[model samples]
Target: MAWVYLIIAGIFEIGWAIALKYTEGFSRPWPTVFFGVSMTLSVWMLALALKTIPVGTGYAIWTGIGAAGTAILGMILFGESHDGWRLFSIALIVIGIVALKISSS
Candidate 1:
């Protein structure tokens, strides 16, 4: 289903984002390869999702998932701040995403 593809793409968005950090400005060979692969797969899956999903809604959801997930991972994996405001913002994004999905039906 298109939703499935979108979700998978969002997950890969997270992967590539984290992997990007490990790339060390793309100087690291292995992480660079990982970033490239992850980025490619992420985009491909998103495109597949677009076959069934409307471009506007799908794009907003995809980027919302990617941004929120990446921000959360940054706090957990990296030494990014885990402030209340940050968590609250992430929660807002998630809530908005849920609203979008619910309204899309």
Candidate 2:
């Protein structure tokens, strides 16, 4: 299903983003390779999802979910700063994604 592809794409998006941080501006070999592979998968899945979903709606949902998920992971795993406004903004992103899903139905 397109939703499954979107979920996998989101997961790969996270992996690639984290790997990119470790890539050291592509100066490192292992992380760079990992990032490349994950990024390839992410974009491929996105394209596949587009086969069944509208581009604007699908892209907004995909990116919104990915950004919110990644931000949460960064805050939890990397001890990144998270103040009230950041939390509120991320919550709004979640709500917006939910609204989009609901409207699509």
Candidate 3:
């Protein structure tokens, strides 16, 4: 259950991050609202997960998911770099996230 919350939180972290680009510095009304909602949910879910998960492990995994996911979305959605090294870096982050989960268990 806690893991589920953490995963959801991480996903929302990615959602808010991607939505940030669309927010256009908070000038866009709809995207700004979406960003705010996603951010709130992300934090709330993190809090729930933290009730059981260690802070260090939980936080690192959450941010790792967010960072890797946002980077992938940036490349796919916004024409950001898709270089081999960049992809490899993202894969490493994912590997770290998986390792953390396994260690925590």
Work out the TM-score per prediction. Answer: 0.97, 0.92, 0.99
lDDT of 3 by residue, 4-89 (tens): 99999999999999999999999999999999999999999999999999999999999998999999999999999999999999
For candidate 1, write residues 14-55 as lDDT tens digits.
899999999999999999999999899999999999998889
Worst 10 residues of 2 by lDDT: 96-105
lDDT of 2 by residue, 8-83 (tens): 8878888888888889999999999999999999999999988987888788888887799889888987898799
Which regions of candidate 3 fall more than 4 Å away from where they truly are? none
Top candidate (lDDT):
3
Best by TM-score: 3
Q: How much does candidate 1 score in TM-score? A: 0.97
> In candidate 3, residue 36 scores what lDDT?
97
Error of 2 at 87 (Å): 1.1
lDDT of each: 0.93, 0.87, 0.98
Candidate rank order under TM-score? 3, 1, 2
Number of clashes found in candidate 1: 0
